[model samples]
Each structure stands twice: as C-alpha cells, then as structure tokens.
Target: MIQRLNVNTEVLSTYIRNSNTPIEYLRQKLPNIDKFLKGELEPTFNQVYALSKLINIPTGLLLLKEPISASSLNVDFRTFNSELLSDISSELKDTIIEMQEKQEFLKEIVENECPFVGIFTFDDDYSDVILKAKELLGNEITRKRFDNYRKILGQLGIFIFLNGKYKDNTHRPLNLNEFRGFVLSDKKAPIIFINQLDSKTGQFFTLIHEFVHLLYGDSDLFDGEDSKKRSKTEAIINSITAEILVPKELISDMFDNQIDIRTSLDSLSRKFEVSKFVILRRLYDLSMLSRKDFMSLQNELEAEFKLIENIKKNSGGGNYHNNLLFRMDSNFFNHVNNAVQQNKITYTDAFGIVGVGYKGYKILSRGG
Candidate 1:
C-alpha cells in the first residue's frame, strides 16, 4: 500500500504560483495535482519530492504548517520597472539564499578576515570612501588593465560572481538592459554579482559601483547608466566611481588644445582602459565636450558597441571551462576546494556549494 504524505497545501500552491514553472506543466507530471492543490488528496512522498525539485524549493519547507513569507533582501532596485521587478527580485532572492548558505558554511571553518566591508557609513564623505578604496586596492589598480579590478577586489575580501542567466533557467539570460550588477550588504562575506552579458568596461564600472554600496552597507541593483533621474545616493556613487577611475586632474593634464575630439577620446580611453562612453562622460563632466557633441558621440558609440556585441554573439562562445572558473571567482572556488580537501565537506556537499555536478566538480578540481 502506498503511504500518502500530508504536506502544506498552501505552501505548495504558493511555491507554484511564484515560480516560473506553469501549473499545467506540473499537472502533466502529477496527474492528480489539481486534487492535491484543492486539499482533496494528500501528496505521496514521491510527489512531494518531485514538486520540490521542480520548483527548486526544499522538501522540508513543504511540510511546514504555514507558508513562509516571501522575504526579500533590502535592495534598491533603481530604474527597474514594476513588471520586471518581481522576476528579478525572485532571482535575486534565490542567489542571495545560495550565497548566504555558502557563507555560513565557510564561516564555521574560517575566521572573519575581512574587516573593511562595513567600516564606512552612508554619512561618510564620498571622497573619503574613494580614498579608502584606492588605499586598499593600491595605485597599481589605476595603471593595470580593467580585469585586474576583480582580482584587487577579491584581495580586499569581496566575493564576486559572474552569471548571465538565472539559476532556475539557464535558457533565459539575465536582462543587462535592466540591471548590470548586484551587491549585498554584509560585513563578512560581502558579495558582488555582475551580469556577464554586460560589456567588459560596463562590468568594471559596476564592480566599483557595487563596492561603494558594500562600503556603505547598502544592497542595491544598478543599471550602470548615467542619468539625471537617478537618486541622490546613486548620483553620488556614480560620480565617485567616475572620479576614481578617471581623475579630473588626469583629464586636465591629458587635454591638449590642438587635439581633436576623436584623438582625445582615443588617448583617454586607452590610458584609462575604459570604454569611449566613460571617457565621453568624463569629458562632458569637465565641459570639454558640448551638450550637443556629447549626445551625438554617445549615440554613435552605443551603435558601434552594439555591432561589436552582435559579432561576438555570432562567433559563438569562448572556452567553457574558463568562463565557468571566471563566473565562480578563483578565491571562492579555492575555499570550497580546500574545504573538500580538508574533509570539512564532502565532494557532494562541495558540488552543491559551487553549483556543479560531480562530473563538473571533477573538471573544476583539475584547474578548469
């Protein structure tokens, strides 16, 4: 005789409604799903397990007396429309839950080494924050290439993750048009997530922007675009990021009365290792470019960048292993691997922490 398991009908129904999974799809899998939801029938263990797996919810939650409230992190979703906010919020909730779990596990075995994460408050001067970031990251960061920014941030105990798709569905990539980066406010295990779909220069700016958020102990999502519509905090952070990346003194020193706009932009872009858009923004800020010229140049640069992106997409993806390792920053990966090696966590547990299967773990272990 098959034993029927009593589960929280409300919780099950809520999970299905919130998830991307359609009710019809679940009905196809469980023919009696309608009855189960209506409280006419209790779900068997297998049915509960399948439902849990499908919705990416834990089976233990299904047995609770009531459905857990949909609590979200304190994130300022700047410029995100109401319709898309729910989807992105759900995605962010899942990511943060996974990160928090990993952080908790690592905290048990590792000491709190990062002391700088929560040192600053929103009341602190933005200049002071910039100076602190420069001191911690070092002057070499200014001279080095853009990718080195991630390495420097990691050294300062910031965990960075890059992913283009949501955890529940890899086929649907994150919309970079909506948001480019995310930050979580935590003294220990502060995290920054960059959408890999964004351009390299855009990602670089986002890294700094999110780092600023971490310093102020604020969690937020940003589109990384300059706009008059931005909030005061967003405006301040954007200005600070630009100043840190391209100092006003540097711009003044580089400006030549004889140089053309194109020549100046090229020189500044190469020197700063930033996109033309950033260089143009700085130029406009310094009044080196007229409002008319800035708008025209920005439109031209955006079109050119879009063409390059399209070409890259058509060329197929680069190395999978490299991308995987990059998405899971080496610092975080090493910690997981060390935990596995030290027997603090089994390989199976490590796989779950790193979000990979046994086979994928094997490849990652080999420096993939």
Candidate 2:
C-alpha cells in the first residue's frame, strides 16, 4: 500500500534552510526549487519527489498536516585516503562495516530521546567536573583497564560505533591515525571508526572524548586542529571529557597548580594513569596554565606520546564489538538472536540483514 501527503512549500523551505543544506547539493537536484521557494508556488509532485530523495524520506509523509524536523541526518564521506584502504586486509574492512552498521542502529534510538537542546546547556564549569574525575583515576590504569571502564559505561547507555577506516594508497603514506569519530546531535550513541592499526590508548581516549560529545548532545566532527576557534559547546565538552578522565580535585590534591610544567606533567600523568599529553590537555582545560605552557608541554611529550604503529598484517583478534554484541544483554544482539531462533529470518538472510560476516555469524550463533 502507498500513502501520500501534501506538504506546504513554505514550511519545506524553512526546514531546508534550518537543516544546513550546502547550496551545491540543493542546486543539483531542484534548480527550480529556489524559485518555487522564493515565490509561494504550491509544491508539485515532482518537487515532492525531489525532496523525498534528498531527505531520504517517504514521499507521502511530506503531506502530513505539520512538518516534522529530523532529529538526525546521516552523512557519509570517505576518509582522506579512501583509495589507500583498498590494500588493507579484508578482515579490517569487515570490522569497519560491522562497526558502521551498529553505529547507525544506535543513532536511530538516540535521536528521539535527546533531553537538552541548545548551546548554553553545556558550560566550562560542567566540563571541568568531568576532567577532575579523570585525574582522580591516576596513571595506574592500563589500556585494558580503560577498555573495561568503557564496556561498563556502554552498559549504562554510551554507544560507540565505527565511522570509517583509513589506509594509505600507492601514492600517499599510510596514516596511522586513520579512524574518525562523530557525535550525533540528539545524545544518542556517538560513532568511532578506528584505525585497525592504531594503539589501544589512543582508541581509549577517543572513546571517552566521543562519549563526552554524546553527553553534550552534539553532532560535529573533531578535526583536532586549532585550539582557539572552538565553539563554546565544543570547549565545554572537551573540558568535561578531560575532567571526567582526570578530575580537578584529585589534580589539586596531588600537585600545586603553580608547579613547574614538566614536574606537574609527570606527576599528573602518573597520578591520573593517563598519558602526560592528556594531563597537559587537562591543565589547559582547567585554565590553571597559559596556552604557551600547554603547547610547550605538548611538544615535550610529542615523541613519547606519538601514535603507535597500525596493525597491517594479522592484527589477530581484538573485538570490543564482538564482546559487546555477544553479551546477550545487548538489545541488537538479543533481537537478532530471537529473530533468528524463532525462524523470523533465515540464517543466511539474518547474516546479510545484520551485516555481520561469516565469522561474526558463527561467533554470534555460538553466543546464542
């Protein structure tokens, strides 16, 4: 059965502008859309069809008596080095695909439950609190320990999934920091596509930072460039994430705020169980040190804190995702298991539907 609705052209125009459509993408499909929007022309079937394609929505839904704003939108882009990923092993590709599918699933759930909306809701003070907490954990924690923390957090509703994987092409050198994470606007789960080759520490920090983004209800990509031009919300989230990882009271108790940069860095690093670089970042967030101090400390730790090499060959098995999915309590896994066992979906089709590869299917089946 098919259904249709007639959406007002004026309301639709408002929706388009508010949503931040790049002019080029808009112009490519509906050249006359501009004219129709400018004037008060009633939208035609063609216009509705064009909009349906652009928004990835059903055509008839456009005719609803009231216009509804999408809480989230999916945007896909290849890594800066998409061509390079071709030579990467198939297992890596499979992992990335699985991560992406799971992220999309989580996003669908979050866009609806967003509690806070707007800029002022996130402030610098809120962020400092998170940083202070992280500091208290101290430097004794290993990457494995942090992973366990993340798993526990996931149980509490922090969703992280892969966004994309990166690799070097024949022309370009491989970028070890290949994966990029994104926070969706509605406080749903954030996305994290890891470099199958990077170290556990960098991945852990990214998971924590991206989780902070989710808490703040944002949807933006972190380019990790320019410290000064950050949006207020971003600044707050960064602050909060730092605090959550290495809290303020703990740092204050361990070292004087006015201590020498290197001494403080080492002490804070040891105390928080985080890298010295992260500790330095936390200090900057606290406003206890000048920008120059932060930069100097950053440079000092650059060599030691440089991202580790990626695993190109057999990275063997490390499935944070598998562990997550196989844990019977996960909603997606539970739903998938029930559907398959009840014969709602054939085993072959179930594998295709969930986008899990053969090995994943076998593992999931065993878990069930």
Candidate 3:
C-alpha cells in the first residue's frame, strides 16, 4: 500500500501561483501536481519529498496543520517572518537556503571568529569606518578594484558569490530590481551575494554595501534602487558605502565644475574605480549637482547601464569550472571538501551542501 500524505492543497496552490517555473515543467517532475493542487488526491510521501526539493521548500511545510497564511494576501511579494522565506522565486529562496544550510554546518566544525564581524555599530562615524576598511585593504594593490576586493574578502573569511542567475540554471535569471544583493552574517563564515545583473560598477558598489552589513553582524536584504521603504539601517549603510566607494575629500580635490557633467562622470568613475551613477550620487550628495541636473543625468545613466548589461548578457560564459569559484564560495568549498576527506560528511552530503552533483563537484574541486 502506498502511504498517502495529507498535503494542504491551498498552501501548495499559493506557493506555485506566481512561480516562475512553468506548469508543464512541474508536471514533468510531479505528474500528479494537478491533482494535488485541486485536492483531488492527497500526495504520497515520495511525492511530497519530490515537491519539496523541486520547489526548494522544507517538506515539513507540506505537512503543516494549516496554511501559514490565512489568505494569499501579500504572499506574492512581501517578506515574511519565517526563515524559509518561501514567497520569493524558488531560485532566490533556493540560493538562500543552500548558503545558509552550509553556513550552519560549518559553524559546528569551524572555531575561529572573524575579527571584522560586528566591528562597528550602525551609528558609528562612516569616516572612521572607511579608515577601518582601508586598514583591511592594508597595502593597496592596483588592479581591477572589485576583483582585488573579492580576493581579500574571501581570504579574510567572508565568502563571496557573484552571479546573475540561480546556480547553473540558465533559465532562472535573477532580478536586481527585486533585490540587488544580500548578506548572511556569521562571525566565522559570513556570506556576501551580489546580483551581477546590476551594472558592472553597480555590482562593486553593492559588494561594499553588503560588506558593511556584514560588519554589523546582521543579515540584510538590499535593494539598490531608491525606494519609499528604505530603512534607517539601509540609509546608514548606503551613506557609508557611498563615502567608502568615492571619498568626499578625494572627489572634492578632483571635481571641476567647469567640466561637462557627462565628461566629469566618466572621468570620476574611472578615477575612483566606481560606476558613473555612484560618481553622480556622491556629487549630488555634496550639493555639487543641481537636483534638476542630477535627475536628468540619472535617467540617462540608467538607460546606458541597462543597454551595456543586455549586450554583455548576450555574450557571456563558456568556462564552467572557473565559474564555480564565483558562484560558490571557494573557502567554504575547501572546508566542505576537507570534511568529506575526514568522513565527517559523505560525498552525497557535500553535494547537497554545495548544491552540485558528482560531476559538478568534480569540476568544482578542480577549481576549488
């Protein structure tokens, strides 16, 4: 006899309502999904487990006594109190759940606390924070600015994952508008995720912002665009991030009001190794650019950024192993491998933690 489970059809329906996954694709994975959704058939244990893994939600959610929500209100967009954070696209939720599960596992075996975590309070002077950031930089290496930052951050115990899509699922691309990046804060294994879908320099700027969030030892979701919902913490983090990216004193010394605004934006971006928008925003914050002029230039820059991103997206990627480093945290990768070697975690367990199978893991180990 097949053991059937009483799955909440209402909750299942709500979860799949706005899912980016096509209904036909889901049917391929769980052929009885239509019946399950309609309450025509209670799914079996195997069916519930298959649905959980496919949708990136916990299996226990399917067994809930009642739907988590009283109604579908705000289930589509709002962030919820649950750690599962189920309302987002499976891609985003999957990535979050994967990184976090690995972090939790690492905490058991890793003993060292990162000195930089919780180094400063939110109210602390940003100028002082910049000095601390510079201290972390030590001797500045002249290179691609963000690449240098990514290297040092990983070495310093902050794991960096930069990607425009979810894992290697090319079909499921990330949306920067919904979220630019997020930080998962841990003293020993903090994680920084950048949605590379943003403009090139915009990604770097977000890296800095998420780094700041890590310093506070707090997990935060960042939306880089201007919004009515931005909090005091976000405002402070942005201010500090902007100042750190393009220091006021440095800009004041180099900026020439007589230079054409367009020319100045280009020059300053190159000089500071930041995006044109960052340069413009810093200038605007300094009252160096008129509100009317800033608004006009901002729209122009946004369009240019989008066009460049589209062109790059069309012409991107071939090296798979090389990409494993950017998409998965290298330091964490080694630690997971080490655990596998000691029999602390099985190869299967390692695969689940890193979100890859045997062949992919082999490729990643070559590049880890």
Residues 1-368 of candidate 2 have per-residue lDDT tens digits of: 11222346656665566557765787788776676656544554445546655865444334433454332221221232121121333333334334444444344334344332222234445644454334433334454555566565555455444322322122332345333334433344444344423345454565666566555454443233233434444545555556666767777567676667788888766655566767777767667778987777677677554432233343554464564353222445545566568764466544543555677666655663
Instruction: Compute the lDDT of residue 295 as modeled in candidate 1.
Output: 95
lDDT per residue, candidate 3, 1-368, as tens digits?
44465667877876666345678989998888999999899876446646766776654455544544323211111121111222356566656655655665565556788998988886687777778877785435355888888888877888888777776677888766566677878897788877767666777887888888777776753233224334556667778778777878889999999989899999889977888878998999999999999999999987997798688779856577776666677778888899789876678667766777888899878884
- Each model's C-alpha lDDT? 0.70, 0.49, 0.71
Candidate No. with top TM-score: 1
Best by lDDT: 3
lDDT of 1 by residue, 256-294 (tens): 858888888888887887778889989899888789999
Question: Lowest summed-lDDT stretch of 10 residues in model 1?
Answer: 78-87
Q: For model 1, which pairs clash?
A: none
How are the candidates ranked when ordered by TM-score, highest leading?
Answer: 1, 3, 2
Ranking by lDDT: 3, 1, 2
